[model samples]
Target chain A: MKIAETDPFSFKEMRKALFFLTFALMVLGTWMTFFYAPTEVVMGHVQRIFYFHMGTVWAATVAFTVVFVASIYYLVKETAKWDTLAYCSAEIGMLLLTLTIITGSIWAKPVWGTWWTWDPQLTTTFILWVLYAVYLLLRSGAGGRGKKARYSAIFAIVAFVDLPVVYISARIKRGISPVVFGPGGGGIDPAMMQTLLVVLLGFTLLFILLLRERIRIMNMETALYTRGR
Target chain B: MKAKLKFIVPLVIIAFLISWLVFAGVRDSMVYYITVEELLEDVPDVYGQKVRVSGTVVHGSIKNELDESLQFTMADGKEKIDVEYDGVIPDIFTDGVEAVVEGSISTDNIFVADLLLAKCPTKYESDEARYQRKKG
Candidate 1:
C-alpha cells in the first residue's frame, strides 16, 4: 500500500492498459492472419497456420530469454524477486513452446506428409523443451528456497545454450524445417511478412500480460509465506 | 562460495554429459537426408539399407499406377533416382518440389519408399504471384 502510494506510475493502471491492448492486438492479428494475408501459392490454406506457429515460437523465445537473464540476475543479486521472475517466465515459456510444437505438428501432418520427424531443428527444439521442463521440475522438487533457487538458476543459464541452437540448426544443418528469415533464408512476400509481424507483436504483448499476472501472484505468495514465518 | 561449489560441480558434470550425448547423437545422424548424388555414389554401400534421400521431383516424371502406387524420378542437379512409393503422398508433392523418401534401394536400383515427405517452398509467395506466373 505504501509502495503504491510512493510510486508515480501506478502498476494497477499499467496492467489494465496492457490487458486491453493485448486483447485488441490479438483480435486484429487474427483478422489479418485469416483475411488480409494472401493464401500461399503452393501450400494453400494450411500455410495460414504459419502465422500462429511463428507467433508462439517468437513469444516462447522471448520467455526463455527472460528466464536466462532473470536467472543470472538472481544468482548475482541473490534476490527472491529475480528468482520468481525466472520461474514464472519459464512456466509461460514452456506453455508457449508446447503450443509451438503442436501447431508445427499439425502443419507438418498436412504439408510434410508426416506428423513428426527428428530433423535437426525439430530435435534441437525437443531437447530445449525437455531441458526447461526439467528445470521446472527441479525447481519445484527442491525443498529449500535458497538452495533451490541457486541450483535452478545455474541450470536455467546452462539450458539457455540450446535456444540459439534451436534457431540456427535449420540453417547450419540439413533439416526439413525451413529457414524463413535470415541468411540463407527464403523470404516471404511483403503481405505475408506484415501478417507475421502483427501476430508476433500480439504474442509478445500477450506474453508480457501473462508474465505480469504470474509474477504478481508469485510475489503475493512469497509475502504470505514470510508473514506466516 | 564453498556451498555454491557443491552445486556447481554436479551441474557442470551433468551439462557436459548431456552435451556430449547430444553432440555424438547429432553427429551420427546429422544428415537428415542423403542427397541423390550421395546415394547414387554410395549405391553399393547403401543397397538394401534403410536410408532417407532428398531430391527435387523431376518435372513430368510422376506417374500414378493402377494400384495407387506412385512412381517419380527424383533429381539433384544431374543425378537422378527412380522412386516408387505406395504410401499416402503429401499434398504438396509435385514437380520441382523437394521430396525426401525413406526406404531402401532394390537390387534393380529403384528406391522403394515406404514414407514420402515433401518440403514446402521456403520462399513463400502470394496467390497473386502464383496467378501471374501461371498466366505468363
Candidate 2:
C-alpha cells in the first residue's frame, strides 16, 4: 500500500486519460463496425463479425508479444516488476486469445459450415492457446519468486516461439483459413479497410489499458507481501 | 552464469525437441487437406480412404439434386475432380470459391464427401453501388 503511494510509475492522471480514450475509441469502433462499414457482398451481414474477430486477435497478439518481451527483460534484469508484467500480460493474452477462438468459431459455423477444423492456421492457433494455457498453469503452480519466476519466464519465452508459426501457417501452408492481409492476401475494400484500422486501433488501446491496470494490481500485491516479510 | 546455464541448457533443448516433434507431426499427417492434384496422383491408394481435398469450385459446375445432395467440380488449376456432397452446404459456397471436402473417393473416381467447407472470400467488398443501381 505504501509502494502504491510512492511508486514512480504510478501515472494516475495518464491512466485516467487512457481509460476515457479507450472508451471513446471502443464506442467509435463498434459504431463503425455496424453502421459505417458496408455489408459484405458475399457473406452478407455475418461479415460484421470480422471487425470484432480482428480486434480480439490483434489485442491477443500484442498481449503475447508483451509477455515475450517482458519475460526476456525479467531474465536479463532479474527484477520482480518485469516478471509481474510478463505474468499479467500472459493472463490477458490468454483471455483475449480465448475470445478470438470463440468469435472465430461463431463466424466459422455459418461461413465454413463447421464449428472447427484442424487446418494449418487453426492447428497452430490451437497449439498456441494450449502452450500459453500450460504456461499459466505452470506459473501458478510454480509459486514464490526467484527460481520460480526464472522458470516461468523461461517457459513464457519458449511459448512465444509458436506465435509466429500461427501467423504464417495459413500463408505458407494449405489451410481453410483465408489470407486477408499481407503478401498473398486478396485485400479488402477501402471503406472496410478504414473500419478495420479503427477497430484495430481501439483494441490496441484497450490492451494497453488492461495491461497497465493488471500490472498495477500485481505490483501492489508484491509490495504487500514484501511489507509483511 | 554456470548455474543459469545448468537450467537454461536443458530448457532450450527440451523446447527445441517439443517444437521439432510438433512441426514434424504436422508435416507427416496433420495437413489440413490435400490438393486435387495430390489426391489424383494417389488414385488407387487414396480410394476408399477418407481424406480432405481443397480446390477452387469450378464455375458453373455445381448441380443440386432433388434429394438435397449437391454435386460440383473442384479444380486446383492443374487437376480437376468431381465432388458429390450431401450435407449442409455453407452459405459462401458458390462459383469460384475455394472449398474443402472431406470423404473418400469412390471406385468410379468421384469424391463422395460427407463434410464440405467453403472458404470465405479473402477479398471483402461491398456491392453497395451495384445494389443501388439495381434499386434505381
lDDT of 1 by residue, A146-173 (tens): 9999889988988987887788678778
- Cα lDDT of model 2 by residue, A58-152, tens digit: 99999999998898788778888898899999999999999999999999999999999988899899989999999898888845688888888
lDDT by residue for model 2 (B82-111), tens: 999988999999999999999999999999
**Candidate 1 Cα errors over 4 Å, as ranges:** A1-8, B1-29, B133-136
lDDT of each: 0.91, 0.90
- Residue A32 of model 2 has an lDDT of 95
- Would candidate 2 be rated incorrect, acceptable, medium or high by CAPRI criteria? medium
Considering summed lDDT, which 10 consecutive residues are worst modelled in model 1 chain A? Answer: A4-13
- Evaluated against the true structure, the overall lDDT of model 2 is 0.90
Residue pairs whose backbone atoms clash in candidate 1 = none
- For model 1, the local distance difference test gives 0.91
Candidate 2 wrong stretches, greater than 4 Å: A1-10, A226-229, B1-29, B129-136
